[model samples]
Target chain A: MLVLKNIGVTFDGGTSIGSTILNGINLRVCGGEFVIIIGGNGAGKTTLFNVISGLLRPTTGQVMLDGKDMAKIPAHERSQYVARVVQNTMAGTMCNLTIFENLAFAFTRGKRRKLLPYSTSARRKIFAEKLESLGIGLEKRMNATVASLSGGQRQAIGLLMSVLAPSKILLLDEITAALDPKISDSVMALANKIIVAEGRTTLMITHNMAHATAYGDRMLLLANSHFQREFSGPEKEALTPSELAKVFGEV
Target chain B: MNTLEIVSGVEIGLIYGIAAIGICLTFRLIDFPDMTCDGSFVLGAAISGILIKSGCNPWLALCAATLGGALAGLATGIIHSFFKISNLLSGILTAFMLYSINLRVMGGVPNIPLIGAATIFSGASAIAVLTCTCLTVVAIFTYLLATDFGLALRSVGQSKGVSTNYGVNIRLANAVALMLSNALIGLSGAIFNQHQCFADISQGVGTLVIGLAAVMIGEKLFPCWSYLLIVPACVVGSIVYRIFIGFALHSEILGLKTQDLNLITGLLIIIAMAAPKFRRRSC
Candidate 1:
């Protein structure tokens, strides 16, 4: 449901200093497809997500979602179609607000914000039901400040928040990288469950190769700012971590 | 304190609290230590005073003051966002320009009086603190923070990158957040002018410091789970801080003259700023 055509982004440091982050990169994801992207630092994985989310304008490219060109759309306007979870735990949620309040904000995404009085009763009920489905016991603490939450709990909330809006696309940028392994497993499991249940298209970036192979339906390795290899279906299932690393020359 | 004194204290406290909440929103959420509060507060008073003197409705005057403060904040946001200026410097620049703007608004005078004017709090007593005007503003601010747009504003303050990823336009959100913050401060200024019967340009000189003090005190007192509680805590804290200052002024043993208000305020800020450091070390 998403396609990027020759997306290129360049940053100018000074008159004599300039760098290209992404060079004519092309990618596509169909509906209900979960794509795992693995890359080293500065491989333009995040930049690719940023371009798709309308946070950065490609110097020369077109981003189309479900066949609609989003080149002219602003970031806030694109929220109705794309939802993103960032690398920082604090970035995924408002630390100062309660879980319910953050969820309320997500519920009204892409709408004009106004200063109206809020009644937490209905919001609490909805959040509680959603939290119960995750079996995380977060429903009981709807009024708790997000800052007080553990990293895993926060990530779960972040994942739930991304899918709360009726958006067609979800971007996960190292979301579980900050959590402990056990917590990360639960979160990944939850992510797989939600994506499959909702039939939403997802693009997840991870540094861990095990997670890349274990989670998504397809995996692609990014090298030197370009897609170097693609693995999927039985081919992905048969590939081992060591063999995958050998192909990328890290073994 | 007598009922009359308590009523007066509460009214004054509520006004300062409103301004303090605005300061807290920008400081804590947006991570912008905005000094525009000082100029915006005075600008609010000046604009409201001028409009009231021209026979405008008190409500309309208040609206003009809020818009004036919003414009000042917008100017600061534009400077910071477009020019990549430091947040503090941008606030300082806007505040410095507002001094002259406020002067012009008051026709070169430093103060304006509203001796016989009708204010929203004209007939409000201790029991009637939640007047129609107060209720309306509270409702409006509460709604603004609860809405999706408000969430985007909070997200921007939390993390610029996350906000962008959420499809929230950081520039627009920052601009609107600053405008709303300064507008609230302006509303307080309009209320204060009517209550005090005069608006002095010097009244806002230490407004930012006062706001910081209120926020610090509120956070210490409430320490609640919900973000919305910060709003009322700031209101209460402002009044409590003022009451503390009033007590110090009235105590014969302290020998603190009323004119030494600025000195006391400065000292209070020093104590407040140091208290956090001490707590961190202790922990």
Candidate 2:
């Protein structure tokens, strides 16, 4: 479970030039719940993710992850409990390294890395099996550098990396935004399958109306630096993309 | 060049080649352009020279010198990681501080003579000893880079954010890398002191430039995308660079002087760095 209480972020706080980006934002995410967030430009969705992930310390808030106050925990340590996939495909993986190397990195998440040899043949076989299951055709090119992969492939790898290791929560920030619609659909379906299978508590931010309506057990519209609307259960299931878009335009 | 000059060139090359590997660890492996080589190189010499002069064991002196260099690297890492100073500035400050520390370690002297001192190279042919030492260093580094910790360190160098997201302590990895890197440079300095029978204050003047030149030249010549070959390539690069310098110095028709060595190294680095760009353009 993840809980954000009285979360607020102000740039240059208490100064004449101070500007509040997020104010009095509160949210609670139960375990195994898939939550989708929709917002227009600069609605502080990514900022909220940043605050939770410890990239930026909130000006004021208590981030409770499974009853632990994560305010003082640094980003690297926080990652043991929180995994994330960034919007920029390139930002999620090392481009110069082989795909196998990137996966090796993910495989050891939350574990102490020692002087042992990295990625035995058996481990490579396991990685290849995982990739094959994704149907991404990346199993054969495990040694190839990630720079040669397309955007959709990279995003899929990013998603795979987040799920490779267990964490208290997973954050996906517009991970499929850069992919073509067909690839995006498959990636989203794959993400949905993984999250459901793993029973992971996930928060995904998107601008797509259809993705907003189609996925996630709960949907939230973030506007004016706060949760303007939240839809769940039968209401979320019955919500149409056109109706969501109409409400999205009003705010 | 005569056989003796060429052989001595390789002997010197083998010793400095260890330093080149250190440069490779920082500049290539982690993409950290560390300037601590200039100071840590002399720090090693100073530590080993003073310890040897005080009747300490030669091998122990070498180890202490390496530890000193690791500490110097730690200083730079702490300053950069904790204080949020720029990476270049962190190395520069550490190197600058080390200048005075090196003098103090040498008992306020600018140089120390190691003549008649029982060094590790005392009972052996300098070339054979240096060659063995260089190969061992290369092997150790090759092994180290293939480990899980090496992957973590490399990831930190490639992308800090992604490394952080994957639970890598970037600051810690950076510090460890700098420590390992400067430790090798320091060891090279200690060996150089034994090789030359003296340790001068200004002996490390162009150490970073020389190591960088060797690394770049090695990559340009071999062009291996694998990490396994890159470590050995740095040593090869050093030997080649030294041989070329020997040839240049010996050529009477070229009319080049010993003072031009730094200028030549600078020019070589420029060409090596720009070579890739030119190749990319042609493609």
Candidate 3:
């Protein structure tokens, strides 16, 4: 579960050449609830994620992780409870390192990293098995540099990496936007499968109306600096893909 | 080259090889454009030379120099991260400040001579000492890079946004990488001053260039070395670079001399850089 109370972010103290991006916003995500969000440009969707993840401090609000105030915690510290997947393929993995090394990094996330071996032969076997399940043939190429992988493969790994270690929350931000249509479907399918199987509270942002209406137990439309509409339970399941697309409207 | 020339080349090369490994940590591993190695190198030599002159054990002086250099790197990191200074400017400012601090550390002297003192290489053969020291440094460096912390640092360099998403503190990783890099350079400075039995303030001016050249040479020689073997490649590159330099200086038919050292080094780096591009084109 997660709670954000009256979050606001303003640049330059909002006095001289200043602007406010996120203002008076509140959101609550229940346990095991898959929440889908749709927002236009500068709707403060990413900023909301940033505030929750402790990367950006709100000007007049606090973030609560399971009712615990996270205003003082740094981004790195917040990662203990929250896992994030980004849209950028390059940003999700280290190109210079092997797939095993990246998984090792994910496994040790939010934990103290001692000067001990991060991956052994046994660990490699487990990692290989996990990669094999991705159906990308990444298992045999455990030692191969991640740079050599395609964008879709990288995002699949990124998604898996976000779930590698135990956590309560998962954030997916336009993760499949860059992939080809065929690849995007499978990656999103895999992501959905993992989120539901783990029964984790998940928040995902996407521009696809079909996905918003087709997946998740709830939907939130963020517009004009705050959450404008919310649907859940029966109302959420009743919404159609065409109705979701109409919500975006003509400029 | 004669035995003395070859011996001197290996000894100096080993010392610089250690420094090159340090440079590789920032430039290659973390992809950080760190320019603080110049000041740290001289600071290492100056601090170690001062301590050895005051009857301290050579090894202890070297350790102190390493810590001191780390502190210097920390300052650069603070300026860059907290003050939001550009990374290049941060290193340049710290390096400028360290120039004066190095002189002050040596009692406002421009140089210190450590002749007839108990140094790390006082009784050991030049070849043996250099070989042992290079191996030890490479071992420690490789081990560090293979750890989770090292992976985090590399990730930070590779992509800050991704590292953030993964919960890595970008600034902390940068600071730690810079500290480790400069510390190794500091130790190299210690060995250098001991081998030459002197420390001069101006000696650090061209140090970064040499370290960069060594990294380039190493990568060129072994393009496919993984992160583990890459450490040894850097060390080997430093020695091979030094040997190349020594040979170029000693050549008679080509009419090369010591004064042409800088020209040759610059040309070698250019050639190494261009070789990869040419290979790709040919392929």
- Highest-TM-score candidate: 2
The residue ranges of model 1 lying beyond 4 angstroms of the native Cα positions read A13-20, A114-122, B1-11, B54-60, B111-136, B146-149
lDDT of the candidates, in the order given = 0.81, 0.91, 0.86
In model 3, residue pairs whose N, Cα or C atoms come closer than 3 Å (at least 3 residues apart or on different chains), thus clashing, are none
> Who is ahead in DockQ, 2 or 3?
2
Q: Which candidate leads the pack in DockQ?
A: 2
Docking verdict class for candidate 1: acceptable
lDDT tens digits by residue: candidate 3, A1-251: 88888988887875888788888888888899899988897888888888888788899988888889998888887898989998889888887778888888888877887788786787788788788878878888888888999999999989988988877689999888899889998998888988888897999998877777778888888888888888875776787877766777732
DockQ of all models, two decimals each: 0.43, 0.86, 0.69
Position B29, candidate 1: lDDT: 66
lDDT tens digits by residue: candidate 2, A132-251:
988979999999999999999999898998999999999999988989999999999999989999999999999878888888898888899889999985787787889888898999
The candidate, 1 or 2, that scores higher on TM-score is 2
Candidate 1 clashing pairs, residues 3+ apart or interchain: A114-B143, A114-B144, A115-B143, A115-B144, A116-B143, A116-B144
* lDDT per residue as tens, model 1, A171-238: 98998889888998888889889988998899999976667777888888877767877888677778
Q: Give per-residue lDDT, candidate 1, residue A124.
A: 70
Provide the lowest-lDDT 10-residue window in model 2 chain A.
Answer: A232-241
lDDT of 2 by residue, B116-188 (tens): 9899888899888888888889989998889889999899888988999999998898899999999999999
How does each model score on TM-score? 0.87, 0.98, 0.95
Clash pairs, candidate 2, are none
